[model samples]
Target chain A: MNPTACLLVIGNEILSGRTQDVNVQYIARRLSETGITLSEVRIIPDIRAVIVRTVTEARAAYDNVFTTGGIGPTHDDITSACVAESFGVPWVHHAETFRLLEAHFAPGEFNAARQRMATMPQGAVPIRNSVSVAPGFSMGNVHVMAGVPRIMRAMFEEVLPTLPHGTPVTSRAWHATGLYEGALAAPLEAIQNHYPTIDIGSYPYRLDETQRGVCLLCKGTDAQAVSAAATAVRDMIARLGFEPYEGEPAKS
Target chain B: MNPTACLLVIGNEILSGRTQDVNVQYIARRLSETGITLSEVRIIPDIRAVIVRTVTEARAAYDNVFTTGGIGPTHDDITSACVAESFGVPWVHHAETFRLLEAHFAPGEFNAARQRMATMPQGAVPIRNSVSVAPGFSMGNVHVMAGVPRIMRAMFEEVLPTLPHGTPVTSRAWHATGLYEGALAAPLEAIQNHYPTIDIGSYPYRLDETQRGVCLLCKGTDAQAVSAAATAVRDMIARLGFEPYEGEPAKS
Candidate 1:
């Protein structure tokens, strides 16, 4: 099997519901395109003890653990020091990282708070954030990144090429309006049984204030099976007298 | 503190970078609005052992644990069984849940695979899914939900009102575009020193085509202190000759 990976999202703002974690979907979608199955994802508060315990556990368990959030210039941004403590490594000012920040800012612009962003666990290598100079770091199995969606996307894109690839997963979707999931239940199950290797997901959606339907999504490595299952679903929907809308070919 | 909540997103599709986890941000934003601090989030594979262990451990460690994904009818969808096993409870078809399914699906549609969605741990209460009838469930401290973003959001909206609201968390965001993080180091430190209670976050964001800025988001229970710090951030951004964007007023 290809190497597996996990993600740890550390932040109180996330759990408290102040911030929407856009990174997970971004990461999930990106990883899927590259054939890496992100096995698990976790979000935690900005607590040092908890961060240390989580980072250590994930690193030991998974081949690679990607963490987002909690690496900013604020006190709540404590992933760096906690990560260092988890590995029993010293938190040091990364020379190249500091230089990047120095070059980006004017004289005396880099302060202790900003300096906090540069501190990484001893022996960690900076993962280049091509969009912004604030570097994400990788030490052993853990890769720490910014929580901001745009920056996180840039950071992941920078490192994605290096990760291992597995079976490329593909998906197809069929949508039917004006019918509830109950109406499509039998045919959907029949379609799933025919394609044992594929995963058929039924999502009931509402639109335009009145119409309702279940969008049946089939995903698998076998394109033929996915296409067949999707076609079956669309045909079934048509038989029910409702026209089905198959989503444009997009990464699920 | 009211009660701590954590979101566990389980899927191999997320880790290997095949999928981006939007649930973390969704759950985080929802929980923060309700004053429940999300302590941690973990994403794991479809393995039963891992899911069981994590569920048991998290239930013991935190007040509430919300799990998303892996509750569908597919073979990999084993969260319900694992969660039941974790609690040492028998997985049985909940009558009400089955009724909901029956209402939405026909008798032929209610096959073994589709019926799998109705199986819940003994003594579990079904969380309403107005969007779909598969129905999420909760027993003891765990809330098992669907992985799809649309379903997860709907489930959260239904579940949030039932939980106890603790302290109301308030936040303010002040942005400074075109100023690198390195330049505002000292003043940011001074501001942190000035307001110990407010949790200040600096997120560097780059617009699609142009413009780079760090949105300094301050969060806490204290309104005055948060405002003072936010004002300080805006003033500092102005001093640096960078345009700033302040977030709108609190909704609740």
Candidate 2:
């Protein structure tokens, strides 16, 4: 089995329904692209105890953990301190991160407000943030990043080149129009039974106001198994006198 | 402490980044509108064991537990059955629910695919779905609904009127346009100290592409206290000679 990861989305705004959690999807897709399955995602409020407990538990369980949000300059931005507390590490200044912060702001502008970005856990590696000076930090098995979508994506890009690569994640999907799930169940089950390594998923979607179709998605590392299962699905649809369109294959 | 709620978003598609978890934000905001505090949210894969474990734990802890997703006609739509099994109940069709479903779906349209939607655990009350025939079911401590945002929100509307009401959740927000967070830190802490019941939050937003400002938000059941805290924040901003534009007034 490859290394699995978990995401911890921390913010009161998320829980309060004021802000949408964009980081989860951003991280999940990026992790999947790297062949690291995002096993679980837990969203906790900005409470220090809860954040610490969640960080501790996630690090203990998952191969690697990523946390987003609560790293800003606001009073509620306690994720860095909380993560440091969880690891029992002292808050220290990262020389590189400090330089980045200084470069981001004018001489006098880099005051306490901007200095808050430099306070990282002891021995933590700074995750370079290209959009802003407030860099994310990584320690042990946890990689913490900004909550904003652009910043989070940038941080992930910066950190991706440094992490160990795993298996190549691949997927093939075929869409069978005008057919319901029941019509495809038996064939789908047979295909699933034959190719247990390839995960077969049937998503029923309503499109064009009146049309309905089931998009059979096959995902796994084994390309032969994925193609085989997808072929079986297309054959089943053809047998039913329906035109099965193999959707545009995802970018490699 | 008032009654609280938790949302369990069950879908592998969400975790895989194919589908974003919109139900959590909608449910949380809707619950807050009805005075129910949304304390926690968890997103797990469509696996039955994970769903059962998360559902069981959340139901035992929160006052009300609402789950979205996994109630469709596809093979992965196992949330309804798993939820029934978790509560030790047999999934049976209720006469009233069947009638409602029948009324929605014409004669032969309610086939096996649609029939799966009508099946519910024993002693479950049907949540009305204004948009579709696939009605959500509420059994014991858990409410299971569709993953689609529109259907979920409509089902929640029908379900909300039935749950017991709690404290009226209210909020006040004051925007400190383009002011640094450090400038308001001391006064913000004083405001928090003055109003223990109200939770205050500061959000930094980039302005005109350069300067940033912190929006101080005060949220609580007590309108007077929330307003007072907002006023205190506004006064402090004025004393600092920064033009603080009050955003939208307190809302429930």
Candidate 3:
């Protein structure tokens, strides 16, 4: 079975709409490619109790829980403490990380605030990234990651090879212009019912008032099933007097 | 207290990274303006049991619950039935909606699939949008909207005026270039502690290689507290010999 994962985005900025979040899409795509099922994603505030409760729940509910944000040195960055509380352990400064960070900064620059980055739950493993000196850590099934897209991607790269893998999920899609979802729903439904193991989806998109289309996609770990479903989708499109295009339609 | 809200985005497309969601930001910003505190946002797939459970839980937890996606004519469109199950209500065709949709389509064009669009839970109120003939519904405090951005925005606009609004939450921000968050974390924490009613956040951003900075934001229901926090943040920035700009910094 493909291991299920949950992404918990812990921050107030996302909920307040202060910043447009690009991290979810990046992590979601990476998880998909790594053959992990990203079951759910949540964006919550930086409150301590909420973070602790969410981490405890998510850690048990999914095979893996990946968290972003709240790992920095600022006051709002409380993921480390909350995660430790959730695990019923004490937050401690890692000897190696403390030494590395202390040496990286100037004598007086390594103050109390910057030193907080070197702390984590006891027995946690560090997940290093190229973008920042402070490392994100992994405590049991939960992987803490940086919120910035560049840093998060790098940390994910470090964690990817370590995860338990399933067959890599892949997809096949067919698209046709000037088609309405209502007109093709029945046949599409039939195709979906036939492929019980794979997921068949119909996405209706409109580029402009003059341009519209529906893209039918089949996704699964089984390569043959995805391809077969795509064939059926293409055939249905052709039967309705539209030229079926392979893969997603180009956006204009 | 501001009326708390939760936005549940239900679709497989978003989870599979097939779509980059714009709905969350739009809803969050509108809720902020409407004086509703958007406490959480969740993205879950289009499974019936999951939908039913999530909807039921979210409706009870928050004062207002907003949902997007899966209100379509396709086979994956199971939100209507699931929502009804969540509320323990019967899913039935609305007489007016059925009549309007039947009249809109040609005699043979309105098939079983198209008819599903007109179905909703008992005692649900239709949320009309200018973009489409099919209506989204508001069942109690749970407002269901379309997946398409244009349609979703219109549905939200329809629901906006009818919602129970709270005191509008507002923010004041000061951003300065060539500053590190580590340098400001100490003073920022002090400011946050002083204004216990408001939220003070320091966000570190990198613009290319040479440009890196921090944006300090103060947000709350109280305008005076927000303004006071902004003054402290600006003073901190100037003390550190950086010229802080009001609002956000230009990304050039």
Candidate 4:
């Protein structure tokens, strides 16, 4: 079994529909490549109690818990404090982080709010941020990063290399235009049962008038099983009287 | 307090980072318009036990629970069964839904997988799907829809009217180029304290080399309070040295 991970997105903007999340997908793909299974994701508000409970629960449940957002130098950014409380540690200023912040900011620019960015839970190790000077931190299994996509990506890249990895997941897809998922479901299920280790999924797309069909995806840690399942899916699509195409068909 | 809603996104593609979710924003905006407060969102893989636990918990916590994905005629699609189990109801074929499927599919096209789409928890009412024939269902306060963006939107539109609403939230925003969120945090907290009902947020954006700043947002059900908080935020930005512009500055 792959090492499981869960993402906790702490932002009101995402919940308010003001900002569309780009972090989840980026982290998901990266985790997959690192052989970590992205098991679950929770998009919660900046409420202290909620954040604390979620962080604690996720830390216990998954091998790694990644939290994005609410790490900025703002009043609503309470993730660090909540995370500290979750771990029953003091939220204290790290000397190195403070020095970094002091060097990054202009004269008199580093106010109390800005100073908040330098604080983290006791015994937390900082994750380097390439985009911004303020670093994300990791305590135990919980990794905290900025909500901004650029900073989050940089932090993830820096932190991921240090984490343990399992067998990387491999995937193959076959698409068939004019083929309905209903007709393919039974046969697909049979294929899935035959290869219990692999995961087979059918995604039907009908974005435009001309483009409509189902894309069959087979994914697993076993590369050979994935390939075999993909071949079976293609054959099934052909048996249903539709030409099977590799990968998703180009949307016109 | 507004009537609360929680969204449950069930899919492996999303967890795999193969697909970026577009349903959350659409649902969040729609819920805001309908005077429903979107409290939390959880994205879980196509796991039956997890789905059942999440659905049951969400139903108990919020006024309405909306689920997207895992409702298709495929091996990975197990949402309906899980939802039925969550509610402790029998997963039975609805006569009306079966008839609709029968009418939509060609002769012999409605296979066992297609038939799965017609099954729902006992005592569930079907939500109309204008985009596809397979109807989403509403069991009590839980609304199940397709994971596909287009289909999810259609089902949400169909089911939203029946849900109870509260006072609609209104928002105002101000943007300031070269202004740091750290400087604004203290005063912003003061403004938020003054108008306890309003939700004040600072979102920092960095696009390209030159475009970077914080966007201050004031949102509440009270229009006057929202406007007042916006004015205060603008004033604070001006006091700090940068000119505050209404709404988000055009991304350049």
Candidate 5:
């Protein structure tokens, strides 16, 4: 069985519809490459109780739990403290981080607000990133990172090397225009039954008024099985008299 | 208090990083317009126990639970059956949907695979949409929707009228290019504390190498309080050296 992971995107901005999140996709893609099955993702609020309860539960549930957002210097940035509460640890200032951040700012510029960024859960190992001087940290299996896509990616890159990996998932897709999902479903299910290890998916997409099609994808940890199932899908599409094209058809 | 909502995006495509979901933002925006508080969103895989457990929990925890994906004719489309299990209801054929879908298809085309789309949990009301002949359904407070954005939006529109609404949440923003979050945190926190009814948020962004800024926003269900807090934020921005600009600066 593959090692599983979960992502917690903690921010009100995402839930408010003010920000369209790109972090989930970025992390998902990276996790796929690293052979960690990202089984679940939750976009949650910054409420104290919610953060504490969610972090506690998720850390226990998945092999790895990643949290992004709510680690800034602002008042609403309570993730570090909340995570501490979640793990039943003291929220304390890391001496090295404190010294580094204090020096980064001018003598008077490093106020209580800025100091908040340096505080972390006890026993956390700092995740150094190229994007920011301030560090994200890992407490046990839970990795907490910044919300900004650049900083988050950098922190995640640091965390990626430390995670346990499974066999990388492989996929192959065959698409064609004018192929309807209803018409394609039966044959696709038969193919899926033949390869129990493979997951066969039928996705119908319409790019424009004239461009529309069904994309059949075969995905699994077994690379050869995925490729073979995809070949069967292509043959099925050909038998249906629609031209089967390899890979995703368009940007949809 | 506003009626809270939870969105579940159920599909392997999303988890696999193969699809970028647009349904959450659409549903969030629509829910906000209707005065429903969209508090959480979970992207979960199309596993039977996971779907059943998540749907059951979400329906109880929030006033409305909206689910997108897995309502297709394909083998991977297991959401309906899982949802039925979640509610402890018999997965029975919806007569109206069956009749409608059967009529939509040609002779011998409405096979078992296609028939899966017409079946639903007992007591489910069909949610009709203009985009597709196959109907999504609402069982209790859990609204099952299509994964495709167009179809999901259409189904959500139909579900909107049936939900209970609260006061619409309003927002206002003030931004400045040179203002830093650390320097502004104290004043922002004071402003936030002064207006307990409003939520004041400071978001930093970089349009390019040279054009970077912080956007301060005030949001609340109380329109007057939100406006008052926004004016205070605008003043605070102007009090600093940088010229305060109104509204979001760019597409970001």
Candidate 6:
């Protein structure tokens, strides 16, 4: 079984629709590549109680929990405090983080609010940020990072090497035009039952006025099983009196 | 106070980083415009127990709950069944839905799996889909819609008219260059305290190597208060020895 993970995106901007979150997808793809199964993703607001509760629950349920956003140098940024409260640990100002922030900013720029970014839960190790000076921290299994895409990506790169990896999932897709999902569902279910370990997904897409069809994808940890399922899916599509093309359907 | 809502995005493809969800943001923006506060968004896989648990919790916590995805004619499509189980109601084929699907498809095309799309929780009202014939449903406060962006949007537009709306949120943004968030944080906090009703957010952006600054936004139900807070934010930026722009800073 793959090591499971959950991503908690803490941002009011995301919930308010002021921002389209790129962090979740970026982290999800990276986690998939790293062989960690990203089982769940929650996009929550900057509420302290909610954040703490979610962090507590995710940490207990998943092998690793990643939280993005609410770690900025602003009044709305409350992720660090909430994380500390969740762990029942005292929030402390990390000496190395303080030094880094102090050096990154001008003398007058390093004010009290910016200093808040240096604060983390006790026993937490810092996740270095290449884009921004303020570092994200890892307390227990929960990894906290900035909400900004660039900073989040940088922090993820730094933190990924530290986490445990599982068997990477491999996927193959077959696209078929003039095929209805309802007509395909029964045979697809049979194929899925045949290969119990692999996950087969049938997604119908209407790219434009002219381009529209169903894309069948097979994914699993075992490369051979996944390939076999893909083959079966292709065969099923062919049997359904439609041509099956490798990869995703062309969108014009 | 605005009526609170939570969005449950149900799909494994989204969790796997295969699809960037447009539904949450579209729903969120619409909810904001309609005066409903979108409290949370959970992007979960097509798991029965998890969906049931999440739907149950969201229904209890929020005034309205919207779920998108898995309501299709495929093996992985189990949202309708799960939703029925969540409310402890029998999954039944709605006569109107079956008739609509029957008319939309060819005789042989309306198979058993395709018939699944017509199944919904007992007593649930169907939300008409303009893009596709397969109708989404509304049971209690939970509104279920299709995963496809076009279909989801159409369903939402149909269902939104039926739901109660509140006082819409108003917002104003002030952009400033060469101003640090740390320097702005203290004064922004003071402004937040001054107008407790208004929520002030400080967002820092690095447009390029040459352009970097913070954008301060004031949001609330009161338009006057939001405008007043925006003015104060502009004043704060000016006081910090920077020119405050009326809109977002130019990116080049």
Tell me, by DockQ, which candidate is best. 4
Candidate 4 per-residue lDDT, tens place, A99-203, comes to: 989988899988899999999999999998678899999999999999988889999999999999999999999998887777778888999999999988888
Instruction: Tell me the fnat of candidate 5.
Output: 0.65
The candidates, ranked best first by lDDT, are 3, 4, 5, 6, 2, 1
How much is A95 displaced in model 2, in angstroms?
5.6
lDDT of 5 by residue, A15-71 (tens): 988888889988888888778999899999879999999999898999999999999
How would you encode candidate 1's per-residue C-alpha lDDT over A89-139 as one tens digit per residue? 899999888887778766766777777777899999888866667889888
User: Each candidate's iRMS in angstroms?
Assistant: 4.4, 2.3, 0.8, 0.9, 0.9, 0.9
Select the stronger candidate by DockQ from 5 and 6: 6
On residues B156-179, what C-alpha lDDT tens digit does candidate 4 reach at each position? 999998888998889999999888
Model 3: pairs clashing at backbone N, Cα or C within 3 Å: none
Which portions of model 2 show Cα errors greater than 4 Å?
A92-114, A248-252, B93-114, B248-252
User: Candidate 1's C-alpha lDDT?
Assistant: 0.78
- Per-prediction DockQ scores? 0.40, 0.54, 0.81, 0.85, 0.77, 0.83
- RMSD of candidate 6 to the truth, in angstroms, is 1.3
Model 5 / residue A78 / CA error / Å: 1.0
Q: Candidate 5 at A237: error in angstroms?
A: 1.7
Cand. 5 Cα-lDDT: 0.90
TM-score of chain A of each: 0.88, 0.92, 0.98, 0.97, 0.98, 0.97
Q: Give residue A201's lDDT in candidate 5 (0 to 100).
A: 82
- Misplaced by over 4 Å in model 4 are none
- For candidate 1, lDDT tens digit of each residue in B1-252? 657786778775565444556777777766776778777777777778989999999999888889988887755678999999999989999998888777776657676777888899999998887676788988888998888788888998888888877876788898766765656766776888899888777666665466666777788877788899999989988888887778732221
DockQ (model 4, Cα)? 0.85
Query: Which number leads on TM-score?
Result: 3
Error of 4 at A211 (Å): 4.1
Q: Ten-residue segment with the worst summed lDDT in candidate 6 chain A?
A: A204-213
Candidate 1 wrong stretches, greater than 4 Å: A70-76, A96-118, A172-200, A206-218, A221-252, B10-27, B43-50, B69-78, B96-118, B128-135, B145-158, B175-180, B205-213, B224-252
Task: Please provide, for model 3 over B1-252, each residue's C-alpha lDDT reduced to its tens digit, 9 standing for 90 to 100.
Answer: 988999999999889888888899888888998899999999999899999999999999999999999999999999989999999999999989999999999989999999999999999999988989999999999999999889999999999889889899889999999999888899888888889999998888767788999888899999999999899999989998999899987653
